[model samples]
Target: MSLDVGAVSSSKNMGGFDESKEGAEKSGVQEVGDEKQGNVKRNMSDASMYATEDEEEDEEGNKIELGPQYTLKEQLEKDKDDESLRRWKEQLLGSVDISNVGETLEPEVKIISLSILSPDRSDIVLPIPENGKPKGLWFTLKEGCRYSLRFSFQVSNNIVSGLKYTNTVWKTGVKVDSTKEMIGTFSPQQEPYTHEMPEETTPSGFFARGSYSAKSKFLDDDNKCYLEINYTFDIRKDWAAT
Candidate 1:
């Protein structure tokens, strides 16, 4: 048997030609792939730009921009209007009054100290001192002896304007005319104001041997009573028993 060397050489040349053709086809496919990748990149960049532009537009196609000249006062006013509008909407929905929702301003006027003095002009402290008991004016009154009711009080700043105080004496649950109502404006002071009620003008002789009470009411400009204080005292026939 004889081997054909020519046919073998021809087969080797055909194999080389097929290999070169395959390399050329592979090179063309690589160029098409690179072009498609570039097109995809360009499309993605265009999509990103469109998305950025759309973000700046409103529903009506108007561009939105924050004002550079926004002032603090204008911002505060806008916020206040927004709050008012919100409150109005809530009131409409719930049928409630928004003004009376929170705590209102209430004034406080308290009697800090009280004392009685003898005719010799000496300060004599009460038996049950001022503010000693939870409530009441704890003092003893004499029938014939003359004494003075000296008191110091404190007024709080909750009182924007002036207030009127009405002092009244109650004997057996009946209102007696003793002292006139005092009206004055109060200021923040370190020293308290002192008031003296003489025995002649007080309800000493008129009050019998029984339990009596003195009440003071503070009234506002609208005649609304805001604060009230009471002092309960006992009356005796003999001055020695007091």
Candidate 2:
């Protein structure tokens, strides 16, 4: 069939050239594609994509977050209320390995490092040390192996009070009671808090002073274990200079 060559040069005018319904539809499709690309750019650039797996369910619930992808350069160009900074902090704090404590046999074994961080500055290195398993960043936790913990503390007047930590580390300490126990003020009363009460709203500062703790046990085959628990935790706060 012979085709009308005039249809090919729609961008230019022809004697009988007219904007057809199909042409409008094609234009709309192009516009939509452009919009979609724009959305991607915004999402990737926003600052709420950087929460820990569990904190992702925090009360802030589903709020957009900045993540690892966002960089300092982006922050310099973002809005004052930009979430990228918070996301950046979370990215810096990162995730912890709750799978298992390494060195199962080392009773003197300080199955020591169990931490849950949010803007928390300290690294959470759960001791799941296993032999010949490609140590550090190369192990995957087994299912049901993700044992849950209370991961909490006691408080008195905005400060942590008598802190108690109990976990089935190796079945050593008393059974872990989920209820919070009021630990008297931290040693020296004037403990340094992450200190969120900043004058101006700041992105957030890592307060290594505030202490938090969790209890863990390292049970042996004979229902025996050691109790050298320590739960010194710190808080991370976000702020913006108003």
Candidate 3:
């Protein structure tokens, strides 16, 4: 079995080739208007509240560490009785019939870290939940500044050939727009891979202020999606206010 790993990064930059045309023609990109933006406001509100909870110090009153703080195996071992952990394990393993013992199983993929990068290539500190549950990854961006999205992950038993990314933008809880892009068709390997959104593709402009998410799907040689992950963040108009 070959281990496949895939990565995706996205941004809005001026003067890049219009890849959107080809992506649209291939039905690789899909967008929905405000009518389908329902409940986004509520979701953002919940995320904001969760961000506050994540900031609270432990009993010792020290700031909590950030980034990939724990692995699924560690969490499961720590709380074997946790129903949530069990459910997550099932999702990762997928459904398999007992009689299909000879069938090949999908490779397991683990996300190492997903974060935003400043123009200077430094990692921006965002509140990430230690247990992997979605939390508001909030950060400040100047009105017209650009930022890059970064993703890193590992695969167990397959080579990754490509990556599909879906990006959605929501403002004041309303989904303003969405886009999809394909990264590559590459050889398979096991070492960690880091993908960075092209500089010109980094998102910018005054209208970029909002809450957004990027969902990435790792694909194999057959163009079949094997592993997926999500990342959420908020673009604030002012860095000093929060």
Which candidate do you rate higher for lDDT, 2 or 3? 3
Total backbone collisions, model 1: 2
Worst 10 residues of 1 by lDDT: 8-17
Cα error, residue 76 of model 1, in Å, equals 24
- Candidate 1 lDDT over residue span 1-242, tens digit each: 11111100011100010111000111100111121101011112333223321132121242223223222222223446587755533332233222332122443556566577657345656543343332554555565555655555554433222333445455555443222222343322234545554343123354356766665454534444555556676666654332
Q: Which candidate is the best by lDDT?
A: 3
Candidate ordering by TM-score (highest first):
3, 1, 2
What TM-score do all the candidates reach, one by one? 0.40, 0.18, 0.46
**Rank list by lDDT:** 3, 1, 2
What is candidate 3's lDDT per residue for 150-212, written digit by digit as tens? 666554542233344544344444443444455433222345556665544324555565555
> Model 1: which residue pairs collide?
137-231, 137-232
Give me the candidate number with maximum TM-score: 3
Cα misplacement distance, residue 103 of candidate 1 (Å): 17
* Model 3 ranges off by over 4 Å: 1-105, 125-132, 186-188, 200-232, 240-242
lDDT of each: 0.37, 0.22, 0.40
